[model samples]
Target: MSVLDQTRVDRPSPRPRRLSWTVSDAAVMIDRGMRHTLRNGDALFMSVFLPIMLLLLFVYVFGGAIDVGTGYINYVVPGIILLCAGFGAATTAVGVTNDMTTGIIDRFRSLPIATWTVVLGHVVASMARNLFATGLVLGIAVAIGFRPTASPLDWVGAIAVVALFILMMTWVSVMFGLIAKTADAASGFTFFILFLPYVSSAFVPTDTMPAALHGFAEHQPITPIIETVRGLLMGTPIGNSWWIALLWCAAILLVVVPISSHLFRSRTRV
Candidate 1:
């Protein structure tokens, strides 16, 4: 053998790199999640259509009765947008619960990929699904005289707030799904989320509520989020609401993501 060949043969082989999760793995999970959302016709229809119905109901049936010192349609549209986003994101809990209860997660565990991608895929897919539904609702709102006075920058800000809220709500739904024993139970857990807006400034000003209800509405996380979005979209005064909303989202994400990851690992570990 040549001297160089002998030296190369004597050297130790390099260790194989350990396989870890990658963006492609996450993308595959996301794709799977999106496909699941598409395949569930009833869920897709309700997530989009239910909010539209609520918008119409509030605008026509209740708009004249509620006075917010502005066009009721304009005032109520922001709340409906949040409502639409919340209900759509709440579906993530059902999906996650289904995955947990079914044997599919076990199959996923048998693969070499990180198990957390399953959760992340669901989260991203929910965000995408909710954003689409929100846009549809917003479009319908516009068609029915929901005129927004927002500038281009304000529109961007409003979108950012909505997206942030959706992301936070999706993760919260994931957490609920993780904790629930059954898909139905998981879905039931989201009812409070859907109901939260009604008590917040989403449908009416907080002060209009009785004193006890007003305190709860003014202090809750959803109120700030709705207010920030409303201010941005309608060019209303945002005050400190934008930061408060961002902080609420950041705090929830910070707390929930880790707990979710831990729960995923704990539940999946065999």
Candidate 2:
């Protein structure tokens, strides 16, 4: 062998230094993202407006004649809350999709940031937005005479259950962001979400539909979720329905997290 070949064989291959960041790093990333989202007043307004308008339009306008079993607003509020959770998650897709379309995510990749934090940061921000929307909807529900007579602990449990659903849905949005070709397509994901509340017992009683349709709707994912949540609020027995809700949330998490992370790596490839 030549001298160069001998020297090449002798040189040691260097390993990349592993990065070890503190909890503060994740906290800082989350806080920065949260602030950016809160600063967008227009976005905040639209997020709050859709559900509020729907609540008003339905409860006062069409709700009078629609006997949903718990009166108008009382029956409608929980369904709207679930819809609100889905709506809030869609914003995550929109924001992330916008960034990907505009090369902002690529720019973030070049920065000295934890790349995993990029998506999680957006998720935390979306959670904050959903929290605001949930609060607003609950306020409207109470004002419209939708009193939830649950104990404080049960109320807190309801919030926690809803929060899990929000996170799960937000992760789905992030997956959409990774895969969507256009912003409009990203926004269109909301259509499927919107269809869910209607197909379930959000706006009306399932018994009002035909027997076959009622059977399907009652067993589908959203019905048990809405039932358990509304039941808790009404001081009625949540039964096995709450466990079913938790199962749905857990199942979504198990499936989506891995699939989304894989797609995320492929799309970013950094």
Candidate 3:
């Protein structure tokens, strides 16, 4: 062969461009997640079931006992939304753990796809699920007695806050899933996220708790988020809760995303 022909032959075919591969790979994985979600009736049911049941139980059964100013349903629905977000994000851990345990991550790693796309796909799907589940809970609240008094901008702010919380929790759950040895362990890891609201201003004001518990409840990450959402929806003074909540979400995401990505790489390495 001529020199130019030899040079062309020796120059390996250009590997496929990465950005396009990442997008397509992430899209495929997202579709996989969506299919998993759609086919799993139990998962979908559980996503909304716990939050609705708790909302009903609180509004009718325990609501009469708890003093949250006017209507207890209105007071607790925001927290319920957050709870639903937590539960939804927790499922990502289970899914990721399942993928890991099943060797799917290894298969993906073998492909010419961006490393982050695998986790990104899971994160995007989880965010959609959280939004849908939260919306369903919100609709049910409206059907019952919950009425939010926020303006258009306030609603926007509330949604942005919820989205940030969802993203933060999703990243954290991804880490949990990657680190977990089993699916059950992964699921169990999110128990604290689910229960964090109970110690916050979700059901009742933090002041009602005992002194030490009160301090913790007042200071935990969930309290400010719940308070910020409540204030936005109820037209109450938000104070600095919104800023604090944003910072918490940003910090969690900044810390968790990279760690989770690294853990995923380590756990999936051939």
Candidate 4:
């Protein structure tokens, strides 16, 4: 064959580039989220002040009479961390709806950024808020004589589980936000998410309640999470509850994350 023919025949196929995401790109999105949260001052209040207020009210008043084997503060502190996360869910819905309503998602889509960046940004913001609130609640717990016998690794693992549970539920809230026809409806998703814990064993031991109530309470999503957390902090046997909590968190995230992203893209058009 001629040299020219061989050269032409051996010409490389143009590679189809696959999209990539980076730490710097995620950081840019996260910083944008931080700025957005700062601009919305109410988010800080909800994330920090409200949880602190509840901690004060519960520990000083009702906490004195309530008994859950651990110190009252210890008993409720984990739940409060979950509450802080629930509060994050409210912020999630509001942020998503506001972005959609204000055409911010459209603006974002016009850029060369990752499509998943929007969800990642909101999730990071929620994680920041929940982490801050969890730290504050732990401070209060320490002040009220809540101590842990568990090792630092155990505590870290517990915190990681709880934080992830919150993130999973926040994505559920984000899902509602994307498909919500009105901002009011979007905000209401958080209300129900918050209420689920109330009906669970968060405040009282499920076995000590009425038979029917106990049965339902023992099986609820929050029960396993609360039991797992309480076990870690108090050195109680976790039994199967830790695995159960993780499974529930995984199930929720698996169902909600992809579905929420799809709904978000389909509805926002940007």
Taking all chains together, each candidate's TM-score versus the true structure is: 0.91, 0.86, 0.91, 0.86
Ranking by lDDT: 1, 3, 2, 4
User: Candidate 4 lDDT, tens digit per residue, 1-270?
Assistant: 556654436743555323444456678888877787778777777777887887777788888888877687777777777777777657788787777777677787776666567777877888887787788878877887777676898899889987888788778878887877777888777667767776676776777888988888888888889888878877877899999999989998899888997887777563
1 against 4, candidate with superior lDDT: 1
Worst 10 residues of 3 by lDDT: 5-14
The sequence of per-residue lDDT tens digits that candidate 1 reaches over residues 80-182 is: 9999899888889999999999999989887767778899899988989989999999999999999999999999889989999999999999999999999
Range of the 10 consecutive residues with the lowest summed lDDT in candidate 1: 12-21
Q: Whole-model lDDT, candidate 2?
A: 0.80
Candidate 3 residue-wise lDDT at 31: 87
Number of the top-ranking candidate, with lDDT as the measure: 1
Residue pairs that clash (backbone atoms under 3 angstroms), model 2: none
| Model 2 stretches with alpha carbons more than 4 Å out | 1-25, 39-43
Native-referenced Cα lDDT, model 3:
0.85
Please, what are the lDDT tens digits per residue for candidate 2 over residues 156-239? 888988898889889888888778878788878866777877888878888888998889889888888888888878765678
The better-scoring model by TM-score among 3 and 4 is: 3
Clashes counted in candidate 3 amount to 0
Our tally of clashes for model 2 stands at: 0
RMSD of candidates 1 onward, in order = 7.4, 8.0, 6.0, 8.7
Q: Number of clashes in every candidate structure? A: 0, 0, 0, 0
Model 3, 30-118: lDDT tens digits are: 98888877876755765768788888898889999988777888889898999888888888888888888996777777767786777
